[model samples]
Target: MAVMDDSRLAEELRLTIGRLVRTVRAVDTMPPGEAAVLGYLDRGGPLTTAEIAQQRGVSHQSAAKTVKGLLTQGLVRVEAHPDDGRKLLLTLTPAGHDRLAEERRRRADRLGRAINAVLTPDERKTLEAALPLLSRLSTHGTGE
Candidate 1:
């Protein structure tokens, strides 16, 4: 029997995980794009639509659409940038923060249950130990 290459196995695992993530539901009234924008705001504080687009790797027009949707939903508000009167800065409302927190909690619970189901105690320990390396891989573009 031949062993599979590590890189091939990792690619398969990443694809499977991505598919699974796409299926999970977020507990927000907003659409996925709006929710993603809110999540980014929750993490990064106030930012302009262009900045959000850059961070999300999307076109400014797409980000503007998302911002408009979020503004309509009352999940975010726009204010004149103090330093730049021509630009607007977007920030989450209190309701948006609450919604984001709830969504995060729901996702965490779902992930915890799934992790508990498939992983043995020792495997769980190993995963916990490997989390930092995995996080680095995720953040540093090494995993892809």
Candidate 2:
């Protein structure tokens, strides 16, 4: 096989991955903004609206709207911040936790099936072998 330049190969790989992600079946019941908020809370625990917005890369007003919807759904609860009386901290309720877990499981199952369909056994093994490198790339700047 001819050796390709690393940058060109990486860009091609990224485009392929992007196409795969865009084509995946998503859970349509939950809006993207709400799902993002829930995912952040699931990973980082309780946070104030400002913190959530920062984590989500969204405006404060956008985060507020997402939080309002979550509150209306009884998926999140607000409490007085111990350090700051004026700002409220938001945490996922039991219902929210359960919902996020279910969503994750569903997406994992879908992805597994899709991957199995597309790749041969050897290719799948090769992809698994590259996971560590991919993870390193993912954590390079985010301080994960």
Per-residue lDDT over 1-144 for candidate 2, one digit per residue giving the tens place of the 0 to 100 score: 988799989898899878866565364358878878899899988899999988888999999999999999999999999998998999999999988888778777878998899999999999999999989987999878
Off by over 4 Å in 1: 1-6, 23-29, 141-144
Candidate 2 local lDDT, residue 115: 80
lDDT measured at residue 44 in model 2 versus the true structure, 0 to 100: 86
lDDT of each: 0.85, 0.87
What's the C-alpha lDDT at position 18 in model 1? 88
As a whole number from 0 to 100, the lDDT of residue 21 in candidate 2 is 63
Expressed as tens digits, the lDDT of each residue in 37-68 for candidate 1 is 98889888899999999988999999999898
The TM-score obtained by model 1 is 0.84
Best by the TM-score measure: 2
TM-score of each: 0.84, 0.91
